[model samples]
Target: MASQQTVFMNHGQGETSYARNSSIQNADQERMKPMIEAAIAELCTANNGLSRGNIVIADLGCSSGPNALTLVSFAVEAIHKHYLELQQPPPELCVLLNDLPDNDFNTVVKNLTTLRRSDEPVVVTGVTPGSFYERLFTAESLHLACSSNSLHWLSKAPEDLTRNQIPAYDIDEHARRERLPLVVEAYANQFKKDFTLFLKLRAKESVPGGKIVVSLLGRRSEGISSKFPRLVEILLQILSVTASEGVFEKKKLNSFYVPVYEPSDEELREIIQEEGSFWINEMCVHGLTSGMDSALITPNRLANQMRAVFEPLVAQHLGDVMDEFVRTAEQRWSLEGSLQDEVARLATVAVSLTKA
Candidate 1:
């Protein structure tokens, strides 16, 4: 098994730029609201009532800030909508915002405090810092578990591969290609472990027939072939140019590959079945077009949004190399006419699961 340290290094921290963007909050609410509402409605109907007991919801990998609260509000509204139809007293609601210990807990608290003004009582609890791969909640306690754009990250690093292999080299195509598989393998193994743990934990924590909604970035299987996708290839090329200009260490360029695997609908269904304890109710793949609502629907805008989420992290790790990489990427995108289209197309998948 890869050590948890590696996973932390690659995936644990939140992107500072993303954390600061109100646009992301707006986009997330718009994207997830209807889906979450529908899932809660189904869960309530299946269980026969919304007033049976306290309703508990957990947002796993919830970064600190208003975004988590936005999710909570959506869940609360869904519950209330169901309650209104039944003419029942609103159920006591418990919202748990969970993330890594290093996350901005203060931000989460500040956001939750603002959300407490609703007429319906909402008990907000912050899970004292922890990894979702391990135990984070008591068994049979959570009614719904929601994780968006978070599960693709591995829970730990691929130590075994790293121990056996030499340091990855960008110029060595064969070595780079070989190392990618190992990295992917390690990420897959950790994803399996975390996902399996998630199902098992939810089984114990969730009431019978409770539901979980997960929305994540995913790619088609064809995207992961021996040759890198155009998007990834472009990123590498930019990194190479930046490195030559002495903006970043040559080795830092090697770390630019996307870490999370984007499973196809079929692949995800298979994994859900194999992992057990949950049944997939709905799955849909859609383009991530919401981020472009106000911006010119060009590829540069799309790339900029991607950079908004990545540049800060790279800067933190690679410093001057980060600036050069961004500049080079922008130049390449401009030259390639990458943003010719009015809309930037990205693939995303959302799935609803129920306790088995």
Candidate 2:
């Protein structure tokens, strides 16, 4: 394992941008509509119609592009519908979009302004730029906080890995087949600390009895993927082969690792229990095949999707070898036999919680 500079998704709306490659995340967000609606309904009812007050909703990790405001749209509508049913005037809304400082907030802000002008004229939109792992809002001011396809990202790579130490064993296969704390101790420990801080910070900002809905990639079973396909394994394989061929210095490959973790149900439950700020109103895991799905998945499209997500960190790591790296990725991914057959079994986990 190695350290990560921690970059956001590909910025522009090109063929290889997150705006185009995020269909998988968009699908999961749609699947979560019922859960989100229920949460908002419960929240509105609990607040006794919330007549004439402002409801504060925050979308954590609301990265740029088409998927940025998906949660916000769903939440605003749900809040309105519930109040309408109660025959009371709907409350004013404060919709805050949050992500890392490097996120493409310019695009997000433009889209938000367009959305409000075209339809949601009364909604107020603001950007909160910082790591979601830290305090980004006022205490006890949030009514609901929703995050999608995020939370699996650690604020920073573990210190042990950042010191440029690479384990001798195969970490990818280790993550899928079995979790050896001996090998993954640093990664596992980092997730525990990051997630705990996330919850603690949110708990301070969220009002008592507020709702939280989070959807993230998870390790569904011992052999299951963490959400989308395990592209990291393929990437590492590419780097290793190139390094062996003297394409780049082996040390470069040794000094690069993507910082991502996929936790199990047991791990999540235990953390929530230990944190003790919220109740698990609901927790469910679903296997999805939506990424590069519906139509047959092509190697070209798959390469582009991976690029949208990983290119920033990968390009930075490879430096002068970036062009060769991209070419090899496309060619090698094409040779991944039966990927079209296996594109339908990704895993995602969703949990809805209430502040205690």
Predicted model with the maximum TM-score: 2
In model 1, which residue pairs have backbone atoms overlapping below 3 Å?
A: 7-157, 140-204, 140-205, 141-205, 247-321, 248-321, 299-339
Model 2 whole-model lDDT (C-alpha atoms): 0.75
Give the per-residue lDDT digits (tens) of candidate 2, residues 137-220.
998889889999888877776677567464422435554345334436677788899999999999999887888899887756
Clashes of 2: 0
Candidate 1 per-residue lDDT, tens place, 237-333, comes to: 6667777777766776554434355555566677789988888888877655564464544434445545644454445545645445656666766
lDDT score of residue 244 within candidate 2: 65
Q: Give per-residue lDDT, candidate 1, residue 101.
A: 76
Pairs of colliding residues, candidate 2: none
Go through the candidates in order and give the C-alpha RMSD of each one to the true structure. Answer: 4.2, 3.7
Instruction: Go through the candidates in order and give each one's C-alpha lDDT.
Output: 0.62, 0.75
